[model samples]
Target: MLPSTYLPSVNRLAPPSDPSLEERYGSLHIRLLYHFEHDFYHHTKSLHPGLKDMLALFMNVGFATPYLMDELLAYSAAHKSILGQQTSQLYLSEATRLQTRALTLYNSASPQISKDTCLPMFLFSSLLSQHVIYNVSSNVHNGLGPILDGLTNSTIIHRGLVAIAKASWPMFSEQVQQQLIRSCQRDYMPIPSSADSRGECEVLLSRLNATDMKPESIAVLRSAVENLQDRFDAICTDSSHAMWAAVQDWLVAIPAGYLELLNQRRPEALVVLSHFAVLLYRVAEQWFVGDLGIRLIRLINSHLGPAWEDWLEWPNRATMEQL
Candidate 1:
């Protein structure tokens, strides 16, 4: 956990020619910038080719906007945390403050959204969402379903992306527009064949012989699992920057009734969610999901143990195979 000390705004203001203040302010940005470019940027570049262009645009926007720069620093700091650096906790605390300041600026702005602020807002939202996902995924001891609270941040990111696309598409240069299109194109993909998923789900569902189970509840969970399978296929096929956004939306995208049943701790719901855990396994190579899939399955087993072992047979087998 990061300490609550406040970092002064020495850097956010114009240089006062005070050597110490300048050094303190300038060094933070310089260090974070180096980390972003040389370390974080290169690692994420392969996530999507068009992300390279988006990052360039983000840098241009960040340099001009102090609040946005704060967000960028925070994001880079969070990225460093993901890399297992020892100084990450301090950086994480500062990242929280910086993100708060950026949001404060946006909220206090005039009613009419300015074109000047649009780019920063969009990039900040996107980067913040990425930071939250990466942060939560890397800290698995906190668990999965609860970590999904970060989805609200992701929702803001998606809305910001949509707003920018609708309002500013015509304003950017042809080169930038082409890059944006390529980035957007990578987000959506055809759903893959469902034969394997269906087979897997059927095998898992067949283990449930509890006569006391509600048929409607079972149906809802079944649908949810099937929906997760579809999403998993879509994510596997997608080669876009938007893929992470979709992954974040997974919880909300499923039927609400399905989630509610899970809240009730329906055994069938747990079984299906276990399979959703498997989807996480399939995408574990993606930094955004990381080892979360394996952890989620383990957590599920811990919660629903030997008594529910029959329901977990397929999921446990799948998880073991992944190991």
Candidate 2:
């Protein structure tokens, strides 16, 4: 574990009650801001360099934005809660409190994505993405239904951040946009793995195509499968691409209509999703991912039952081996 100390420039950081910040959100928040940046910020950065660096460039240098700051604290606290800290309950309570407040503030804002708000909103959504996954996946006492629901929720959030990124992409300068695009495409979503999933994907596609679903539905699902294949190929062939980046990108890339298939509990859709669990399995050690890949595999397998056991064979085996 990294020490909870600030970098050399800690002296320049504003005191918790800096008049301007205190004026906006009071001394408690001012203290929370200082404590987070002073203690946890550097520590957290060491844990996820890509995440910390990205947010540092986008949000940290400025006075903490209300919602984003809450989320950062919430995420850090949630992580602490799981670390067997002596005050884990307090951290957990604070995590939940801050997370709720952050979401409320975010949802209450204007609907439109504007130049000024877009990047901040995007960063907020991005942090919230991992927060939800970490929060949901970490609490597993409820059984399969809640786990499935949590994953479904993560997928929904994944789609949302994708929308925000697409809308905000054009706002950057060509050079900066290219850099940001690389971040969004790779560092921004570290969910997939470079593990060989071609066999599983092929089975998924074969089963998908044989189904009697509507042409459009089949087409949508097929596009998603092909997208997976292309990504796996890229991961295998390209040295620059992060293998795990492909994990969440599938959820991000899939169209809304295809998600309806998952909502409807379509066997093919479930099967396709189960294959994505392979990506999760590949990166199961990641802090936010954990055993989620295995959980997703079990949920889908149990949900589909014997009828689709053959379809789930690879994903099921991949995750089960971890046990």
Candidate 3:
């Protein structure tokens, strides 16, 4: 891993001291960025947390520095090979930070911040696109295989689906949108070796399709779903509770309007809606167990239906009894 204290080289933006200096440093930087992003994409779970922080810092610099932006664009245009490399670096280095920054920048009132921040925001969107396509095309079996296995229980399956749907919908780039729809069109193979796991995967996929369709932007919805599907599948297959939680949080963050749309058009939004409903049911169930559960049940029942009541009776009810 690169030293946490490492700063961009002193000569980072210096005019080529020599003709080759520009070519050499530029090439090296681009290549380094590529490997860094590749590692993040393929080995994020295994990566050191400190390294992840460092990468996030670099990504901050990329977005925060005007000089770096100019250089990145110029380098990308001059050396097409370097484009993906630079993008990967910016993405893998501090992806979550960049994402947070993009949202902040988007919400900021300053024109300068908004204009300058769009590049990084766009870059982040691009990274999402790449992940969506890769997961849809190559990792489906390992990713979705296990999640489908556990879907036999309507509640689990429903929550899983909602999680997937929520992950896949909302504001995103056009490229990602198209890729998601294309991925869904592909044949789905069951995990013959793990019946329980495969059932979960199917439920998750179904739910993903549900919420994904709620976004007014069909293009954005498609791409987001593709990416969500991959992540959702991985969660079930790996039994990654933390990852699953992250997905659930993202789903919960969606606007109420979108969720309402899904509810209204449940047939078209079955995949995402069922998944979201199930997730809500689980959270409500959790609330019911702690001293807070009664209040939560009342709060949910005020707006939702008997689904919550049914969930309270599930055999897995004890799983959420503690809160």
TM-score of structure candidate 3: 0.28
lDDT (Cα, tens digit) per residue for candidate 2, span 107-159: 55533667667667777777777777776676655665566556666766677
Error of 1 at 150 (Å): 4.4
Greater-TM-score candidate between 1 and 2: 2
Candidate with best lDDT: 2
lDDT for model 2, on a 0 to 1 scale?
A: 0.63
lDDT of 1 by residue, 38-57 (tens): 77768877776677677778
Which residue segments of model 3 deviate by more than 4 Å?
Answer: 1-119, 122-260, 263-302, 305-308, 311-319
Q: Could you estimate the TM-score for every candidate?
A: 0.72, 0.73, 0.28
Deviation in Å, model 1, residue 276 alpha carbon: 2.7
Instruction: For each of the candidates, give the backbone clash count.
Output: 1, 3, 39
Assess candidate 2 and give its TM-score to the true structure: 0.73
CA lDDT scores, all candidates in order: 0.61, 0.63, 0.34
